[model samples]
Target: MLRLSAQHLHELAQYAGDHGVRVVTENWFALLDRPAEVLHLLEALDGEVGLLLDFGNWTGERKYADLAQIARLAESTHAKANYDADGNLQTADYAHCLKICADAGFQGPHSLIFDSAGDEWTEIAKLRDFVLAAL
Candidate 1:
C-alpha cells in the first residue's frame, strides 16, 4: 500500500505536468507531516510537483521549525487563521507565522483559510486583507 501510494503520487505528478497543470501536495497527512519525509518526497519528485504549505496543519512541539523548513519549498500556501467569537485570534500569532514564511522566502500567492464564528465571506475578506497587509 505504501509503495502504491508513492507510485500513484509520481504518476499523478507526471500526468499533471503533461497536462500543463501543477501538482502540489500538502503536509496534512502522516506521511508528509514531518520535514524529513516531506523533503524526501520532494527530492524524489525532482520538481515534478511542488508543496502547498498550510499554517494550521502542523501542531505540537517543533511545529514552528517544521513549518519554517517546509515554507522554504512552498509553491502555494494555506494561510489559515482561527478566531474567537469576538473576531480576535484565539492564540495563533499571524504576524509571527507570516514572518516565518517570509524569512523562508515564500512569496507565493496565499489562500486565506479563515475559521471564525462569523460570516464566511466576510471572514475570508477580512483574513485576505490581513494577509495582504502582512505579505
Candidate 2:
C-alpha cells in the first residue's frame, strides 16, 4: 500500500516482513531533505519491505534529490505520469525516473498511477521495461 510518510517506514517494513505481506511505502520525498535518515531506515529494512517511490510526489520541495537515492530505498515504485508546476499538470519525466531506478539496480515492477487514458497496465509495462533495462 502507498503510505504517507517515511517516519514509519522501518516499523511498517518490519511489520510487513513479519506478516508476510509485501510492503511498499510512498510520500518518500517527505524525507528527502534528510536523506541520511532515509538511508538509515532503508538500510535497516528487511528485504521483504519495498518502496512505491514516486517522482511526481517529489516535486514540491525536494525536487533535486536525484533518482539513485530514491532507488536505493525502493523495491517497487509508483510510476506517476504527470508533472505539476504551480499545480498545473504537465508531462512527467518518466524516462529519467526510470533511469534513476535503473542505475540503482532495482529489478521490480513499477506500479502505475492513472493518467490520461491508461490503467496500471501501461505504467506497469513501462516499469517492467525499466526493471529489465536497469538490471
List TM-scores for all candidates, in order: 0.88, 0.58
Tell me the lDDT of candidate 1: 0.80
| lDDT of candidate 1 over 31-102, digit per residue (tens) | 787888888888877787789998888877887888888789998888888666678864456776788889
Write down the worst ten-residue block by lDDT for model 1.
Answer: 83-92
The numbered model that scores best in TM-score is 1
The clash number for model 2 is 0
- Candidate 1 error regions (>4 Å): 1-3, 85-87, 90-92
| lDDT: worst 10-residue window of model 2 | 83-92
Q: TM-score of model 2 relative to the true fold?
A: 0.58
Q: What is the C-alpha lDDT of each candidate?
A: 0.80, 0.59
lDDT of 2 by residue, 41-109 (tens): 555554445566676676644453545565766767776756355432243466667677777787776
The alpha-carbon deviation from the true structure for residue 26 of candidate 1, after best TM-score superposition, in angstroms, is: 0.6
Which segments of candidate 2 are over 4 A away from where they belong? 1-15, 27-34, 44-48, 60-64, 83-92, 115-135
Say what the RMSD of model 2 is.
Answer: 5.9
